[model samples]
Target: MPDPCSAIVHPCLPQNIFPLFAPRPWTLNTLHIIHRRAALARLLNPSLRLHAITYSPFSTTPLHISTPALLVCLAHPCLLGFSPLPAHPITTWHCQSPQSPPSPSRPPCCHACSPAPPPQVPVERWEEAQFTWEPFHQWVMNTSVYRRAVHRNYPMSYPCGVWANHFYKFVFIRNRKAASTTVTDNFDKCHYENSDPRLCIEVVSLNRLKERGVDPAVMWRDYFVFTTSRNPWSRAGSSYDYCSTKWARTDGPCRQPPFSAFSRDPSILGKISNLFHCFDRVGMYHDYYHTEPVAPCITTETGLPAVDYIIRYENLSSDLPEAVRIINQRRDPSLPPLPEPKIYWKKKGQAARSHEEQGVESNTAALVGHGDKYHKCGMQCVRDIYEYFRVDFELFKIPLPEADPAGDR
Candidate 1:
């Protein structure tokens, strides 16, 4: 068979004009070949009118290219030099029946050709294109308090809670008691150790970076910022359990208080409030767990969220991998998939027993040991906690536990 890319010369065209017709890559379809010939004919004789007959690839019927002089080129075989013909008048010819074999006087008919189908787009690519930032922008607009804070030009009073893995261009806003340790550990495993002594020793927040004269705006634009959020009530319960347990071992005033007592204790509450005021307060060494509201921690100096994505703790198992995949794809399309982080936490029974042995009746244990304490807290306590972290529940879309019609107490 002739190469599809080779040029076809027509006897009608002058030698000087024939050399100008360049070969184009095309398949051997009857209609395409006829169209090319028709185009050439038009270029050679601009006044000549032509009619092209097209056929389906499956049909064995032959097509005829008719000119103004009522001349028909049979199966377009003469153009391919398959048979002898007069040069000047473009002598017409005919093809034998499909059942008959080709004779010296006639050539086989050219098959009809259809254009190739377009390439398929990858599903991930489709998803990326369809994804929109509109919903997130709308959510930010709905947050009235956050909007006010941003508009009022108030300086962020608390640490911005951002942690960075410079090597991977990963930034995470740490929410106390929101599986921060798991997130930090996973990043450390995937990339080089964060060597800045301040961050090397502990997770650094965006505000901390600002205090050290490091501009967070650069990281905000340059890195992929992400953070995990837990339901506000559950986060509070976890904070109480983790912090009370830690402080109980030390000489702090909040030492060993059960959840119920701790929630009501004036001294502990005052200290917790003061800790928020003092941005330098470290949760590990202080009585406070650094339970800053989730909104403030994730918000940048400009009042916008510092991170690009928020991975909910409720769906962390699935969401974390997705976030990692998106980040990896953005950084390097050829990078291999990252292994999912293995998360392990103490069982409720073990946690309760450990706390009990430490001489404190775990409030978490008193309130269903394994479940959320939001439902177990009295109405007054719920209201107080809700009022305290109201912005977190509203901004993050963490639903409030349904109140019992008959008061919580």
Candidate 2:
């Protein structure tokens, strides 16, 4: 078949008939109004027998192009018509079958040419379920709040790669200082933009947004959401350190100075730990199963639930594969793959270099403030996320490893 992208332009005749003198195999079926005059001339010519529209009635005029290049005229066909003496002059021609023309009290027009059918689904309900997850996976990875929390807490990490085409909704309610960046990067890598108008859309979040006058499920319907969390004590310190960095900054409350310095005195740290825990005091001890879950610090602000997936900063690499597998089992193949999974790190002393190369200086107060608030808000977010989703930590099958607090026991 000839490529339609390189078709020729032409005009039509008064009778709305197209003429073609050449004898050859032609398959063109439709024409636009602009080229109606030229197309009509071709149909009138005797040598070329225009192919009538398929399933057309007897005496119905047949129209076909002699060459594939002739298809351009179909882009803009002209229609003329006229009524009797008491009415307006009619010069409109039915581009479609006149026998089944559109309403005439209005402008004389015809139905838009039918477009080709979409690709067939491999299976009925099964296919729908699979494609449902692609958008869901995308929603999970797009949360800025989740990504910020992950990058701040984890040492070095990146998102996991997409393993398969199928996926369903994913909800990632990031906890303070978890490996959420890795997950975010992976989501960015998975899919490409699609122009199709039929695909479903969904939204994923760190927490539910309903109670705050936002419905996450409805807002993200036909979509997926996802997020992660961190070990509480470690998360608190990481949040504190990140806020103190003076390089990464955002708007939020409760962020203050001296972020890099962890005061040995718990009293001093407690003073500033309103939303999140006192990192300086809790940084060295605390475990999830050993203690009751802490109340969320920023739950009122974001209206997000705790995390659905409480990914431990200590076990992200091992735990990520299962998440990918679940996604693959649910979505369609057209969605993009997640980015390659790896540990991403700010090189030692590289933050200053980044700012220098960009010809900009990092603001000490701004960066520190953002980092501190991120954790304080993130921890509460994760708790609500997990509770809302009813996702048990056992599904991740992550085993905690022993830690050496002194750098060498």
Candidate 3:
């Protein structure tokens, strides 16, 4: 499609990108010898070969040819794909090849006496260096780990990292805005073969072990465990929007969802105050700071680590199906397979697509640091989110985005 250049190679990845093959250096004259259509293609797409082209007025080499050292795409290189040359490749060719004969190919203007002013601009162009917030924010959010789930019938989300149903022999561990709502709803309907499916409610880590004293190994051993993830940038954005937008509207007092027939179970259902925390800024943050944060729940620092599969939000269309197939195989055949978790979004969540309203997620958990209050999410937002969720990102092998000098306002 787009000449598969930057997409194929990048500055962060050097010669290591093509460890198997290497090419010999070719000079300026080599390019001109190519077929006419090929030259035309270079004229049409410069970055297709050179990321950016430069020229100097005092060079003896004809203005027509540039000897880099460039790429299939062009960017980081000495002159060719080969590295270990000058730290910074010459942006503008300064060679004065006196022995080389000027080709008839040199423009008629190349009257040796007064070569045309090095063409004001390269015939073809490449990168756009402008780094703004909105576009970058949007791009970061739509990625596999950063994608947010929102659509008609926005499933009610309950941010919990530990959830398990002994009856169904499955466990789920994840963070907020990761389709926990869909998993929770499906488990509610999946009960032991003959038991009351209506009362089949999954329990959080606190309830399963602390409150009910269930064995930790029960949830960890031989269970069809799974989890979900969204890009931290988008997850933070979704959390801010859903809690304040047309959905939960956390700006006001809000109540957690009631348990099923087990709603009356004092073991799973804690005190009324615990259930009805104010969703206001103070309330929501208090709830998160006090209750479920990503780390302490999912990290081995707090408990045993176990997960059979992870459903990434970005690949939901395909990932969900694969996870379902595996879970059904391990689960009891009589138990109806869990349905593909549903998704939901809000008016503001869809439009804002920004982090203007939130702060560093791990800050709420406060397990790592006390640095919080990043309300005006900007270029630094990606770095801040990654710092707190670094473990999760690394554990799943998600690539961290390069941070910019922009302040974390």
Candidate 4:
């Protein structure tokens, strides 16, 4: 195949440096280096997709990229003929599907820096325990929370991806982040499958089984419905960095505010006003995604747990396999498992750049990276995020860490 990078990289960077700085099948890790090298080549470009308020009955919508072309001459997947970039580098203990051979104790070379994964587990263990397969699946469906909100008209604000077809028995509703580049790319690179090929059908509702006008419990009995969550502290830092890159207006969501100020403020974490109130708002669509509470957004209006699984982001290497296993089982179980899961990891963040380049508040700069965020923000930030997403920690049973992670390390 022609070098996908040749045309795109030419204007901003030399072709030769690509091989030297990063290896074949390049990634954002390489993009960071390219950004530093091509400061003069920064293309002040933000494609219309950045602000797309897209909705469809079937999932598989176009990717929503915030800053399509930053100063970097590289890293945007769209630039590489829609290739998926590698997931962010985990410092240790990351891996491929449970079936793949275990990585060596350490990578043979520095270039092969991906953290080693645990030994492959038998495929039987990959999923038999997922949400749909849960013994409590019946109870979760019968609970008042699910029943009351099944037909009630909750505000349809969040985005979700879906894959429904004849052969695919389990009605897996890929949540709002479903069609996202990171998850899509991460699919069994083993299978080279991203969104399901039966993509044309589009229906709204991350509340997956509700709109079918049938009992969601029975309707979803076979499908392995599930969603994922991340640590609120890391989640917040990531949100800050993303918004900073897309930051344009001061009054709107993702307007790129100081981290210390943003995390502690209750309004930023808990605000999810109805559409009628925010309909005419300038950044209404963008704001809708940012500040909504963890539980409310994922559950039924009457406060029912909507999904069967909660794949905690921290436990992804172990958890993602459940989703991957079932999806493959539906299609072809014999396919090789995906390579290193493609999660959204950023070694450097845009907020630090904003603070460093634009001289943002000193406090904000100190709290920029994930490790720096919680400690630097202090106890108040931790308590606030915990309270904001209280149901998540409680229902999911995710333990709250001490305010500062540095102490634990």
Candidate 5:
């Protein structure tokens, strides 16, 4: 059987034409003329099979011509009997069925054929088909809250203020100086079936958890998350006093330095120099008490807030129980009520006496009075401290303290 792709000739072409061309020398020029005529014949009747006639002296049968030569023949009109070809030319014709439809893998005829136009797609569908990163990139850029919270060194980076309780299927972000120890301790007791309230739950850092094969994405999705925020100025003062006393007991360079000396060394030459060097000796204190914005800690990968609730440390007495209720409802509605946190005065030694002696009725009043000593050096020093923690004030909706414009120096 002939090859499936071989050209076919229409029966209308004279059968005797093959013998006239068979006797000629089969040179390149002779072959070209045959191909040209065959191509023209194909064009005239696409249904026709056009073949090149070639003969060897030893055989009566014509040699099989290549498909390429036959295709080239389709290009010349004279070969199709539209006009007379050169007398020396040899041409053969065969009667066979017209070629079958081109295979799916192969394109149809040469220049005369074109690919079908691509299937039309709806505009919305096309847009959706494209993969673009702009939306995701924008979300990442909008994580200003997370960025601010991590600006200062904390124990953890990704989950800045978070404390996880796997047993309760919840995570609590304990803001610095916001009674975190109390909150975390209560969770610890709950985790151990209330066996030992003082077991001290270890607040794991996000990075460390990841290193241990815990995926943050999974944790965020599976756990109920929450955080607390405090009044920035009050928190700042409390942090300062806490760090001062804590460091005094240690042999650290910043130990026991007066807030005035700590803010800026009087002997520092440049104006901005003192500001930069302000917390150098007590860098640990600075890191621990830095402005931790709540947004970053609770933000999802899409830059949306991920926490189920936010408790205000200022109203923690009332707010915490409500937050606990929400968590319990989501996890196991039958869980027992959370124990009330024991409120303890954090001020110890001189700081405790100072607050008592001043007869300060509120934490805010006590912190402001304690923080006032730092301002003795100059309002600029206080301004510098405020600027360092400016994000905390802005994020938590706390008002900034009034500054003396003339005393910026």
Candidate 6:
């Protein structure tokens, strides 16, 4: 039979916990040294440490040595067979000279150090910046007194500060492809509980509702106003694609693609015409012009303060705090959560490259509708829309892409 110590097993423990186990040859003094060694290693480097190594009963070994050194053959029956003592004496020694310092480790050179590699940026650093705001978005959403819900229909009376005398209400004038749905959702959440109708509004185009001869003021007093816009070219393109495809149901006219069946063929011009006739103060989407366009909506048109705040679709995420501030400041304390800005397309790079490579014309009608004849009318229509809401456009800091320099041919 083999020696009784032959079956001794050295169970692996984490290096940090090594001190807890008595050192062999199972003596009180060796155990004390083991604990001290672990503490010393930890103090040297808390973040990096050597994984513990195993021992065997076959041969003599040292207690400690640096630089990938291993100690072995110290037997202890108490560790495995429940014996109380170690089988041998253990010694420690420095493998290298006492006065010499260790050599630095050399890292393998590879693609990481390539010349065109991205610059190394330190983690956990952020730029400090400050924000300024107008009255509408300044304090509206967060003011505790305003978040309460009250009863009544179109306009609910608000009880707070200078706004206490007036009834507050809002209308979400949803324009096609103009992020109106997101606006509607945010307003819907502003009231207390799901049952409160204070935050709800029937979203329809201004033109459609105005025909009913409703007082625009009575219809939209004291409420926050919001809308969105896109680059005209992209908007026209999107309108055409939606009106011609199955995806039209998502935003555009829902009565089927042939929305112009009775009037005229649904061309790009028709789509733009439909959009112009649909909403009030439709702002540009490509560059958000909330500073000007939405401001007027919150303020009175005859220039009295009516609407509370506006959010640009392009910078909606960053612009949300502004909206909250305005709403909380003027209207209600309980502002609804802001909706994430919705993006229609994702692979813009591939789509743009393909469009460029294919040399696709924006308008199907040459210079006319899709071609030459439609070009003149298209240009005029675009200008009319711009002039109608120049204040909104100008304030948002988005310069309308300079109109085609040639003008209407």
Mark the 10 consecutive residues where model 5 has the least summed lDDT. 117-126
Deviating ranges (above 4 Å) for candidate 6: 1-169, 187-195, 203-221, 246-308, 331-409
TM-score: model 6 vs. ground truth: 0.29
Over 333-360, each residue of candidate 1 has an lDDT whose tens digit, in order, gives 3444455666533223344455567675
Count of backbone clashes, every candidate in sequence? 2, 80, 13, 5, 7, 44
1-409 per-residue lDDT for model 3 (tens digits): 3334534644323343242123444322222212111222243334436433332211223334323323445432221232212111111211134443444533332222112111111111100122123532343234323556422111111233455666556666645665556555554434357645432555443333556565554445345556665555455445433443322333333343222211122111112223453333433223222222243344332222334455555444444566666666656666776666454321223323333234423212221121132333344555545554555555444566554456434
Cα-based lDDT at residue 318, candidate 6: 37
Model 5 Cα lDDT, one tens digit per residue, 1-409? 5444334342322343543233333433234334444444454456554555442211212234433333222332222231112332223222233443433322223212212211111112112223244543333334322343222212222225456665456666666666566566554543455554333244555455566476654555456556665555455555555544433233444344555544432111111222333344544324332433334454432233344445554455555665666555555445554555555434322443566577754433433444555556567666655665564444333455577677643
> What lDDT would each prediction earn against the true structure?
0.43, 0.31, 0.38, 0.38, 0.42, 0.31
Please, what is the TM-score per model? 0.45, 0.28, 0.40, 0.42, 0.44, 0.29
lDDT by residue for model 6 (1-409), tens? 4333233334422233332333333322222223323223333234323233333211112234322221223222111111111111111111222333333221121111111111111111100111123332222222223643421111111111011111233333333443445544454432336734443444233343466454443433223443344433333334443332322233454333332231122222323333443222332121112112232332222333222233333333334444444344444446553334343322222323355455753221111122221243455544543443454444333354456666642
What CA RMSD would you report for each candidate?
24.6, 24.7, 23.8, 20.3, 32.7, 28.3
User: Which one wins by TM-score: 2 or 3?
Assistant: 3
| Model 2: per-residue Cα lDDT over 35-109, one tens digit each | 222233233332322232222111113344455223222333433221111111113243434355345432333
Overall local distance difference test of candidate 3: 0.38
Shift in Å, residue 326, candidate 3:
1.2
Which of the two, 2 or 3, has more lDDT?
Answer: 3
User: Which is the leading candidate under TM-score?
Assistant: 1
By summed lDDT, the worst window of 10 consecutive residues in model 2 runs over: 116-125
Selected candidate, larger lDDT, 5 vs 6 = 5
* Best-to-worst ranking by TM-score: 1, 5, 4, 3, 6, 2
What is the Cα-based TM-score of model 3? 0.40
